[model samples]
Target: MALSPKTKYNIKRILPFGVIWLILGALFLTVEHLALGNQKNALNSAIKLQPDVVLFALTGVTIIGLLVGCIEVLVLRPLFDRKNFATKIISKFFIYFFFFLIVILITYPIAASIEMDISIWDQKVRNRYFDFFLSVTNLSAMIQLGFSLIVSLLYSEISNNVGQNVLLNFFTGKYHKPVVENRIFMFVDMKDSTTIAEQLGTEEYFKFLRSYYGAFSNAIVKNHGEVYQYVGDEIVITWTLKNGLRDNNCIQCFFDMKSDLYKKGHMYLKKFNMQPDFKAALHFGQVTTGEIGVLKKDIFFTGDVLNTTARILGLCSTYKEDILLSKALAHKIMLDNNYSFKALGEHRLKGKAAIVEIVSLLKNP
Candidate 1:
């Protein structure tokens, strides 16, 4: 069977470790070559007399890199992410044990193929091979791999701390000043958060929130939404108009978040005695977006659209609805018999003079 796209991508990611292995392997071989210049051993003396030291370093580390790369892509990643605790521990133990043995066996073959040494089976030659394998080459590769691993971890941490797209936008200066852009906004708040916190207590409530938000993360990403802010028990998600309407991503995002939390209901009940339920209000309009703050800068959004969005969210509890949106957003979407929405009539919301036509969205039964 062909490898999956995810596996192919992972293999490409790991292949660059080969360069680190090659550099370390070259340094280790050069040191050994220099040290052997004074060795009394006949085999070491003869091998040091040869001009193939650089050749050996390049070939041997290439093999080590290839093996290590395969081990990471095919074995370690799957083992590390195993959902079952016992299986993860047991599989990792055997995988590492087998990994070291395979790398060692491949080392000498790579050397012989590149150097074309015919006396490779002789006692002196075999001893030298065993000594080199046990002493420097593979050991050097392993040590250099630790450095590569650290770099990879640091890079991932930085990317996560500042979102990948946000970092790119900063460098590109996409929002240097307040610029008007059409955006779709969703203000999602946990239902009865104050009551839930009172029932669960502070510590447990925090844990509950952790699980609750974590569950919705995948849905938001899959639906092309950027989490604009996370306040107390609410998450504000936004998207460009083009992305929001594509495949009905904005609408699908709500259903996906609802389904994600619904699926985790039993787990939440078992641990925390309650699962989080939320209400959301979505609207689409022009908003001014800019980089704001001097102490710790953030890309900020302003204008009446946000206030209108918050007020729409306020109507949820009063109207006893799970999802609500202004007609502004509804009018732009391609409904096409895919969803059901009911007109709630035009009303002047609490903080605004102008009336907004709102609607309640229902899952098509």
Candidate 2:
């Protein structure tokens, strides 16, 4: 399970507080030993200090530090995880203020109990102890906050980079290691893609492809479809029949893409004078899917199902169709009010042993 950004940020923020607490606790112990001034034998010197007072002071400092550290690590860190920079800065300020206030409240009584008074004690002694306590607490808080911010920034940058790489690999066919199973395969290929590419020149054509891929990929993912590959101006999308062929989600996804493209394609064409359009083929059956090759690995689907889908795509020009689905898909999905499809009857798909039934969706009923 992924941690929420806020939770991760919070953990990073509080880590410094924990380190500071430990250091301050250790400093308190060392200071107590020195104040007693039994350097000939430090242990003996420590023992000479009123045992009860020594124990109380040490115990108080340790307990306070432990409490503060625990709160920071457990409660504070999680709250700031993944927050925006402005929010994070505000959160840090509040956390520091609260921590400082709590520490002062806890320690002031202990100071009073020891009868440590600025007016009564020598200026050096009073100033030294007061300054030491305040400095240690404040320094610890500041260090922890600074460390947390740096860590959070680094973490965010790293995560963003990783996510970008994953998305890139996904589209580029580098990270596609297909899990073998029976599935419905759909391929959408832009019509006149070569002419569009030729007309636009290389850079603008590549930009158009990226934008087209983005829109199509969004639709596929939204419909729980896995986009397997992009071959030139074509995209291959796959989904399990058990889940994907019901309620016409796959068809709906195409319509959504059409609507999106119709709205955006014109703007692209205005610059390039090349309208974007596509033809799609959907087929269902058993197929083996996996990564192929050793050096240049790629996800591949094997068996007659792939060949037949390709043939159906070839018939798009003959039938004057924009989208084609096999009878198997249309039969399973077109029963409900949400879908309607027109049967084109059985036709001999090239290089196929049997004639395949094809259909085109009319509209969402």
Highest-lDDT candidate: 1
- How high a TM-score does candidate 1 get? 0.66
TM-score of each model, paired residue for residue: 0.66, 0.54
What total of clashing residue pairs does each candidate reach? 0, 8
lDDT of each: 0.74, 0.65
Expressed as tens digits, the lDDT of each residue in 97-142 for candidate 2 is 5665676555544454454433434565445446545665446434
Over 1-365, each residue of candidate 1 has an lDDT whose tens digit, in order, gives: 97743455455545555655676666666666676666564343133424575676576566666666666556664446434545644554455556556755655544543355655565655665666666655465456545534443333334345664565567569998678999999999999899999999999898888889889977887787888888999999999999999988999999999999999999998998877899999998889998888898788889888999999999998899999999989988887676988999997998799999999998776
Candidate number achieving the greatest TM-score relative to the actual structure: 1
Off by over 4 Å in 2: 1-180
Model 1, residue 299: what's the lDDT? 84
Error of 2 at 164 (Å): 9.8
Off by more than 4 A, model 1: 1-143, 167-180, 288-297, 350-354
